[model samples]
Target chain A: MRATTIHGPFDMRVEDVPDPVVQEATDAVVRVLRACICGSDLWAYRGESARQPGQRIGHEFLGVVEETGSDVSGFRPGDLVVAPFVWSDGSCEYCREGLHTSCPRGGFWGSVGSDGGQGEAVRVPFADGTLVRLPADAVSDDRLLTALLALSDVMGTGHHAALGAGVAPGTTVAVVGDGAVGLCGVLAARRLGAERIIALGRHRARTDIARAFGATDVVAERGEAAEAAVRELTGGQGAHAVIEAVGTEQSMRTAVAITRDGGAIGYVGVPHGSGTGLDLSTMFDRNIALHGGVAPVRAYIPELLTDVLDGTIDPSPVFDLTVGLDSVPYGYEAMDGRTALKVLVKP
Target chain B: MRATTIHGPFDMRVEDVPDPVVQEATDAVVRVLRACICGSDLWAYRGESARQPGQRIGHEFLGVVEETGSDVSGFRPGDLVVAPFVWSDGSCEYCREGLHTSCPRGGFWGSVGSDGGQGEAVRVPFADGTLVRLPADAVSDDRLLTALLALSDVMGTGHHAALGAGVAPGTTVAVVGDGAVGLCGVLAARRLGAERIIALGRHRARTDIARAFGATDVVAERGEAAEAAVRELTGGQGAHAVIEAVGTEQSMRTAVAITRDGGAIGYVGVPHGSGTGLDLSTMFDRNIALHGGVAPVRAYIPELLTDVLDGTIDPSPVFDLTVGLDSVPYGYEAMDGRTALKVLVKP
Candidate 1:
């Protein structure tokens, strides 16, 4: 089997690796159909995050179940499925509450001892809890396939941001990023009936996609200017809800600044650089609600998958570039160099 | 007229001052019926907060309207009323949203340009916006008067904590303080139908009030141990909501730690010392929601007033000591020395 691995900073390669096997009663082996490089993954590629040589990388994928362990009852061999970024036991307290990312027994894929998603084949633990099945007739269309692949991570994450920020009918929203997840946030807000959607991004290509995804306004400014633009568009009051898809100090501050008193900021970006420091005085003064973390993709996948299958939304445009398994290195470079919004890899 | 003035740290005096006059068209003059030393006030009395040698010092009071300018129409002379800690214009966008504290034309009482609530007579700006009328029939009872006074700040702040944390039927709540506001939070949580309430306080007197106010459990431990106790009580899952009434780093951290994943922490304490710094990594991983700031007392006063008038709750018990206007300096001492939970002053 060929799998993606990182040797060091700026070093990505596809090399021969042993095929995964079902090793536990709740485990299943999957043959990867599609995988992609995540914005978070670029942290390591750009030397911003530490990673040892030969480390498995990638945590988003869709595949076909090749083998199932005896304890896996909901899924069987040859079934098309999408797996969330984290695997968990479905019965835990957190999982029962639909917070699977915080499940006590859950773990992220491609971390320390787990197999990465960007491989020809991989072993999945708690198979029934981590994987959502697709309709048998659905897998034949490449366009729908691309959309389904997104439900594994990015789309679900964007939905989380909208939900966390309390985006609802007749409200104005500001989305603070142009990445795949941010664009998906715009789509989610629109689907939820937000009266107005503002996308804050400078890139022409990404802003165009943002508009197509339902952004009613696009602010190409950064920092204070971006906040000023949002306030101007909101009649000088600021947006009712803000989606922070980029986890930087400036992005968080901007999100907070452009949110009206009693409004909420839903932030899903993985924190990088100097960690977030909130001014308690300001948050208290305005009564702002800040909510978001890692998305519970497993909990949201079922509903989002239905939307994808019904053609209610098509998020495949986010995958602007695609390549074969052997070109995984190029896929990483495309995303890191800002030439591709997201890269899809076929295995 | 006479008023309470701070001459220096540990030096409070009731001295002669000029009588308040209706200066602005939107202003009204009120004769103080009662005033109380607030927990926040102790910070200045103890020299923890900086203050000038002679500054008007109180901000919580209920009074009778003595006079009103031509523009003040909703209030009449001799009518009893309660004022929120801050005064606002009532027509700004923030005020329209019920966030009066952040109103564009608002300012806090006792600041340089405003008259403090402790004086014999004080001028209130934007009277219609800052004051809520009391039922004429209910002002004759001392007990009811004390409870009404609580609505000006502490009790309303506690209600904000519960509301901010999304407290409702069947949720387990943990309150992290033993001050008047924290005890009021216990009462508010119970009033809101929280199934279980855990109070984190060590003082016996305050713990008794917590129990009377509806705390089902009390933990005397601080820091990690307090968090451990909450987890143990909740079967290692943590509370569904936490109310943080002490604005310290340790209290905030404990509140965050004991909140279950997907839970919320409502904090209303005026942050003192170093500002709160949240670890975005941990908060993101747990999906904790942080919501709260200064209580929007005016927004909640009506409903809370009805509760007080109907005998559904009696917040007056928190006023454990009483003193005349001349003894306000002693009232500050008693609270600063922990000799009194709260002190009510009659002018």
Candidate 2:
């Protein structure tokens, strides 16, 4: 089998690797049909986030079950399913609370010994808890497949951001970042019935996708100007809910600045730079709530899946480029270079 | 008229001042019957917070309405009332949303030329918005008067903390700090039907008050030991809700550390000192939600007042020392010296 491996900075290779096998009673071998490059992967690609040489990479994938261990009851051979970025034991307290990311028995894909999602096959632990089965009829549709693939991470993450921000009917929301996650957040807010969605992004291509995702206004500005634009759009009060998907200090500051008093910020961007630029005194004075983290996408998958299947939201637009398994390195480069919003890899 | 004035650090004096009168259409003059030295006032006393010489001090007070301006409709001259620490225009959007602390037209009680609560009389702005009326019969009872005074700030602030942390029936809550607001938080959590309350404090007197207010457990250890003790008490899962009533960086860090994954921290200590020690990465990885700020006490006074009037809660225990008009300076010294948990002033 061929799989993606990281060999130091900017060195991604598609090389022959042993096929994954179900080794634990709770595990299942999945033949990945779809996977994608994630923005977080860029950190390691740029030598910014430490990575062991020749380590597996990628954490999002949807596939067909090839083999299952004795204890795997929820899935079987030929079952179509999608795996959340992290695997969890569904019965743990955290998992029961819908925070699968904190599941004690859970671990991220591509961690030291785990199989990466960008590979041809993945040995999924806690299979029954980690995989959500998709309908057989939908597997044949490429568009639906792309949308379903997003459920593995971006879509569910967007939903988590919306839930964190308390987006509801009649809410005015502002989303920071033009990445796939931010675009999906706009869709999530709209699906949750937010009356107004303001997207802050300088990229026209990404902003167009944001508008398609239900952004009523776009602020193609940065820093203070962006804050001013959002406040102006919101009648000088700022947005009721702000989604911070960039994870940079400035982006976090913009989220804070553009949040109305008593508003909330749902931040899902992986913190990579200097601390999130938060002034506790200001947050205190304004009564702003800060929530979100590595999103518990598994908890939100079921409901978001229903919407995706019903044509209520089409998040497939976030995947602007596609590549084959051999071109996985190029996919990473394109996303890192901002040439692609997200890259879909068909194995 | 006599009022408590700060000539400089450690220089609190009872001096002759002009009597308060209705100064605006929304103003009402309040004759101070009960005022208390707050933990926050110590900041100005210690010269930590900036203050002008001879500035009027104190913000928590309950009294009889002495006079009402032409447009003051909700209050009458004889009405007994408790004024929240800050006055707000109830008609503002933020005020309507129950975030009076962020009300654009609101102002703190002792700012610049405003009358302080520890005075013979106060010309309260936005009379209808800032004050909550108490039953006429209760004013004569010393105990009831003390409890009503607590509603003017501490009790209401505590309620804000509980609400911000999403306190609900069966929640396990932890309150950080042993001051009046923290003690009141323990009571507020209990009133909200929290099944278990863990209070983190070092002082015996304050912890005793906390226990009486419904804390089921007490952790006297500080720093890492306190975190370990709390985690141990919660079966290593930490508290479901944490109230950070001490605004120090250490207290905020402890609040974050003891919060269970997906838990929340509601902080109401007026942030002092350096930045709140927050690691965005930790908060993000744990999915911890941070909420709260300077409490919008005016919005919570009504509900807390109902509880106070019904004898359902008595926060007056926080007032361990009492002083008359001329001894207001002694009250500040007592609180600053830690000889008094809180001091009640009669003028």
Candidate 3:
């Protein structure tokens, strides 16, 4: 088997690696069917994350079960399934409370957890809690390309933003960022009954996709000007809810600044330290509700899984490009170079 | 009439000033029964609030309705009342939504609104929504000194903390301040069914007041040590709700860091942006809810009017001293010197 590895600044390699085997009784081995480079992956590619080199990279995948340990249940060899980026025990109190990301035994799929998901095959612990079954038969390459892959992280994240920000009927929502995840947020806001959806984007392609995903308007302005555009669209009151998809300082500030007084702002950007210099004084005066952090992707994947299966949501368009696993490194480079919104790697 | 006025840094004057009159059609005249110097008043006294010379300096007052403008209703010339620092119309959409502070016609008592409350007679606008009627008869001087005057701001702000933080039964609440507002927060938390209250304060008097109000423990520690103390008391999980009464960056950080994952932090402090940088990144990873700004004192005063009338939540002890309106300048200096928790001035 081959695995994608990040070995320092601007360096990515697809090299032959040992095939993963079930390491725990609750583990299952899965042969990767599809995986993708994430918007967040670009952070480490840019050497912005605390992530170290020589680590297995990638955390989103749809796969076929190859084998299962004794304690693993609900999954068997040859089963088609998707897994969330974070794995949880599923039975813990926190998991029961639908906060799987905060589950005591939960950890990430790549650098911060047991192992990475970039390889052709990998061991998935807590299989019952982590894997979601597909339609019994294998999905088509195109249908499964984006939706199943998105189920692993981005779609759930977008839903997390909409739900956390309390977007409801007639709500005016502003989505910050034009990435695949942000586009999905536009879709989520529309599905969640947002009366107005504005996507702030600098790229025409991304803005078109955002409009396709339900963005009612797109602002080409940047920084304070972009925020002013949002405010202007909102009648100088700001959006009722803002989905902060970008974690940079300016984006976070824009997210806060473009929300109306007593409005809610949900942010899922994996932010750096500089974004912390927010002014609570301004937040206090506005009576705004800031409710968000990292999206609890695992907790929301099940319902989103149903939505995808039932045809209520099609988040698959986030993957604008799909390629064989051999091109995984180029996919990372393309993402880093902003040539692709997101890349799906069929391992 | 005599009043307290700021001449310069540490320079306060007890001098005669023109008595207030209804300058607007919606205004009413209140003959001050008692006015108190607030912790925030000391900011101007210490020159931290950028005070201009000879500005009337107070905001907390309880008074009698001596006169009403032609448009004013709901009270007669003899009705005793407690005036919310902010005067709202109670008719606007924002007021209807319970955000009276942001109401279009609302007015703050001192720095940003119609008039200051430290004088012998204060003219209040939006008369119908700004004043909560007292009991039919006159109340005691001590009760007026503590409960009603303190309720004008600090006590109500403490209540804002508990309400914004969503404190409830079985909750472990951490209050980040030992000021009168923090002490009142302990009382508010207990009233809201918080099972454990932790007060972070080094002052002996404040620590005692906090315990008297319902705090189970007091942690004199600051910053990380204070967070550690809160975690130690909550089985290493931190408090379910954190109330930040001090608006400095340190208290904001303490409140954010001391809350459990998924907890709510209500900060009512008039924030000085220098503390903890209002770091939203750390807040993101924790999934904390930051809800607070200026207290909607007008919103709460009606219900609290009943509480004060019935002697249910005694806030009178917050006033450590009382002086006539002529001694208000002394009150400001005493409070600025930390020799007074709160100073009440009788007209």
Candidate 2 per-residue lDDT over residues B264-311, each given as its tens digit:
998898888424567788889999889988888888888888888888
- Report lDDT (CA) for all predictions: 0.89, 0.91, 0.82
iRMSD (Å), candidate 1: 1.9
Pick by DockQ: 2 or 3, better one: 2
Off by over 4 Å in 2: B273-275
* lDDT string, candidate 3, A1-347, tens digits: 88888788788888887778888899999888889889998888888875666778888888889999999879999898888988888898667877777777777877543557777987898999878888755466568546867988889888888877789999999999899888889988998999999999989889988988899999999999998899899888899899988888778788888998888887787776425535566777878777778777878877777877778888877887777878988898888888999998887
What RMSD value applies to candidate 3? 2.1
Most lDDT-accurate candidate? 2
Tell me how candidate 2 scores on lDDT. 0.91
The weakest ten consecutive residues by lDDT in model 3 chain B span: B136-145
Q: By TM-score, how accurate is candidate 1?
A: 0.97
Listed in order, the DockQ scores are: 0.71, 0.76, 0.61
Model 2 chain A: which ten-residue window has the lowest total lDDT? A272-281
lDDT of residue A165 for candidate 3:
79
lDDT tens digits, residue span B5-96, model 1? 88778999899988999999999999999899999898888787787877898999998998998999899998999998988899887888
All candidates: TM-score = 0.97, 0.98, 0.95
| Regions more than 4 Å wrong, model 3 | A273-277, B138-141, B274-277
The candidates, ranked best first by TM-score, are 2, 1, 3
